[model samples]
Target: MKNLVILGAGTAGTMMANHLVSKLPKKDWKIHIVDQFKTHYYQPGFLFLPFDIYTEEQVKKVGKKFIPKGVNYIQQRIEKIDAENNLVDLENGTLSYDILIIATGSKIAPDEVEGMMSEEWKKSIFDFYTYEGALALRNKLRDWQGGKLVVHITEMPIKCPVAPLEFAFLADSYFKKKKIRDKVEITYVTPLSGAFTKEFCSKSLGYLLEEKNIKLVTDFAIERVDFENNKIIDYIDKEVGYDLLVTVPTNMGDEVIERSCLGDDLNFVPTHPNTLQSLENENIFVIGDATNVPASKAGSVAHFQAETLTDNILLYIDNKPLKEEFDGHANCFIETGNNKALLIDFNYKQEPVTGTFPFSGIGPLKLLKESIFNHWGKLAFRWIYWNMLLKGISIPFVSRNMSLKGKNINN
Candidate 1:
């Protein structure tokens, strides 16, 4: 019998398990999935957790519940990857595989920045990227009087790149609802030149900061956190004081990748941009935040990649040429708060432009424009994520490849 192993049972890994379970011959092969935790989190909800938008129960569910019946769900710590021997060392045992899928996703490495993991962490300084951090921040914001609320991003390639912006927007709405809007000074700090890297998006979405009265600090590469002084010092000696600091720290892949010597400087595995195959080994496939694929590290991106990867894995098993099909497609909803959101659909070749989506000029969902309908779509996605996305059920009309037919592309 042949063995197929998946390293992480997160979004990408779970989707692949569901996609391949029926396709692969059950009599000839066994499938196994490895993850340390028993609970699966809807990571996007982390952005809402701090503002009391979602309750704790809504964000997490049993990990084993979503895993397919035929697949082996091993809930244990992964010690290291023996890539040379095609073996994964777990806490209690080791598994060998004929084909390996690395879905071990990225995580916040706050210690990467000096003073970031200091004593004040989760007190004065907090992060919304993790469940613990979000809950802690939620508690902190519950009864606290308002002051300077700085939402900052440490570097690029972070998961859900637009999330910090969403947090800032939501905080504005949250404070307003609490009747403390006048007391809170919201500042958005980023190393990027603008809220968005794409010129079109930057130009189009620039009004959000001004409209919300949120301060924007651009190109400030932080040197360290001055927790004692309640400020962050940037490289050029620029300092931004904060009464409360909510930051997205340096994002890197799991340490097991570093232990296995299979990842780059950031511990992200080198991967073929189109095929989703690890550049180091064709037998090893990568998806989601694990691969250095230049795609946004968002669940929607993982959902799109899953469809393409399922087909490629079958091709790999058949000894056929794999298709270079994944085009960095990502569809996301930007929550602008106040019961409004903006939708964006793009691939490697296209930046987001204003138009209709899922249809040519007839979309009920508008791209690059804020609307209550879009906000509903964003909220509705939580249901879609649990019932459909993880089960490898295809979403209606939203193909894996991004369509330019509906977009108002200027180039």
Candidate 2:
């Protein structure tokens, strides 16, 4: 039987396995998925963890529960990939494959920033990217009486760019609910020149930051965390002191990519923008946060890519031309707290614009504007993610390719 090996059973790899296994003839192909961890985290849930919106039970599940019966699930740590030999080296043994998919996701390296790993890490400074970190931050925020709370992003191209901003907004709400809004001060620091990377969305979200009284310090490149002084020092020596620091540290692809010698300087797999196939190796493919695709490393991107990628994988097996079409489509809801949120939709060529989503004139969801419906959409997504997304079932009103039908192009 022809073997197809998939690495990392995160959102991308999990969905890919489900898509391909259902379509490929079971008599001819054998699918094997490998990952070190057994628990599957609804990673997006991590964003809400710090705010007490989701508990540990809501987000954690067994990876084996999601894998279809026809697929082989191997729990092993990947040591490296011998891409040249079409083999994956595990801690225990090496597995060979005819075709390989790299869906190994990205990770945050707090140590990449000096002083970030110091004693004050989970106490005065914290990260919400991981479950443990998020839970720690939640506890830290609970007893935080009052002080300058800085929400900083050390670098860009990080997973879920909007998450830091959401944290800032949520922190504001959390403080107000605790009767400490007047006692605490909130500031958002980023390397980017605006609240968001996209121009139109930046304008909208920047206004939100201003409206919420969250001070914005743009274009500040963080150099180190001065835990002794409770300050974050930037490259230009600009300093922001804080009693509590919530940071989005430098994010990079998995270490196995570096060991495998298949990734770029940032350890991200080089991928063609339209095709979703690994540029370095023809027999290999990459999806999700693992690929440098210039798309948001969000679940929505993976959901869209899985559809197109599944078709291309089939084409490759049949000696047919790959359907070179992934438009970098991504949609995400920005939680602004107070039972309100904003939705944005865009592709590689277009920035987010103001309008309705899915349907131009008749959308239950509006883009680039904060509304209660959008908040419900954000909350309802958790259900969809667990039931439909991970199950490889496609949702209506969304497509594999980005659609400009409902978006206002003029901005």
Candidate 3:
């Protein structure tokens, strides 16, 4: 039987396994999935963990539970990816594949920046990108008296690019609810010139920063963290002081990509934007955060790409031309604090526009506007992710590609 191997049992890899198990002929092929960790984290919940919005049990599950019954699940660390010979080296053994899927995702690299991971890490400074980081920050926020709370982003191309902004918004609500709003000062520092990389999105969401009374320090590229004095120094010697620093450090792909020599400077694999295939190898496919695609490295983008990639994988077995179908479609919900959120739907070409989703004029969920309904929708997504999304059950009415039928482009 032909062997099909998948790397990482995270969001992207899990979804691809579910998508292909039923599509690929069982008589001719066998599937194997590898991952080092046993837990499957609901990554979106990491944002809410620091604020006590989601309990510990709500964000994680046993990784083995998500793998389909027919697939082989291996829980082991990957030593390297020998892409040259189409082999994957695991800690225990080697895997040869007729087809390989790389869904190994990106991670926060605190070491990339000087002093970011020094003596102050998880003490006065923390990150919510990892479970340990989120839980530690939660404990820190539990009984600590309020002071300057600096939410900073070291660089761009981080996972869930809107996450740092959401944390700032939620911190506003959290402090207010705790009756410590007057005691806390919230500052959002970013390397980018505005709230977001996209021009339209930056303009649309810019007012919220001022509305929340959070200080916005733009275009400040950090050079190092002064853990001794509790201040971050920028390249030009500009300084931002903070009592409690919650920073998103530079994000890079899995180190295996670096050892494989298949990735760019940031350790992201060079991938075709639309096809989701590796630029160097025709038999290998890449999806989600691992690829150097210019799309937002969010879970919804992976779900959309999984559909297109499954088809391409089947075509490759039959010696057919792969479809250039993925369009960088991404749908994200931005929490704006106060039990409200804003949703944005866009592709590589389409900018986020104000409209109703899944319907032209009758959407029950509004886009680009803060509402309690959107907040509920955002919270309800956690359920959808566990039950429907990972199981390969398609979301009702939401197409894989972006549709401009209902979106008001003129706005």
- TM-score against truth, every candidate: 0.99, 0.99, 0.99
- Candidate 1, 214-329: lDDT as tens digits: 99999989999999999999999999999999999999999999999999999999999899999998789999999999999999899999989999989999999999999999
Worst 10 residues of 1 by lDDT: 402-411
Model 3 worst lDDT window (10 residues): 196-205
Off by over 4 Å in 2: none
Q: Where does candidate 2 clash, by residue pair?
A: none
Candidate 2: residue 201 lDDT (0-100): 82
Query: Across residues 1-411, which tens digit of lDDT does each residue of candidate 2 receive?
Result: 989999999999999999998888989999999999989999889988887889889989988899988999999999999988989999999999999999999999999999998998898889999989999987877777998999999897899999999989988888889888999889999999998878778876677887789999999999999999999998899999888999999999999999988888889999987888899889999999999999999999999999999999999999999998999999999999998999999889989989998898788799988999999999999999989998899989898887888888986
> Per-residue lDDT tens digits of candidate 3, residues 82-185?
88898999999999998999999999999999999999999999999999999999999998789999999999899999999999999999999999988999
Backbone collision tally, model 1? 0
- Separately for all candidates shown, the number of backbone clashes (residues 3 or more apart, or on different chains) is 0, 0, 0
CA deviation > 4 Å runs, candidate 1: none
Ranking by lDDT: 1, 3, 2
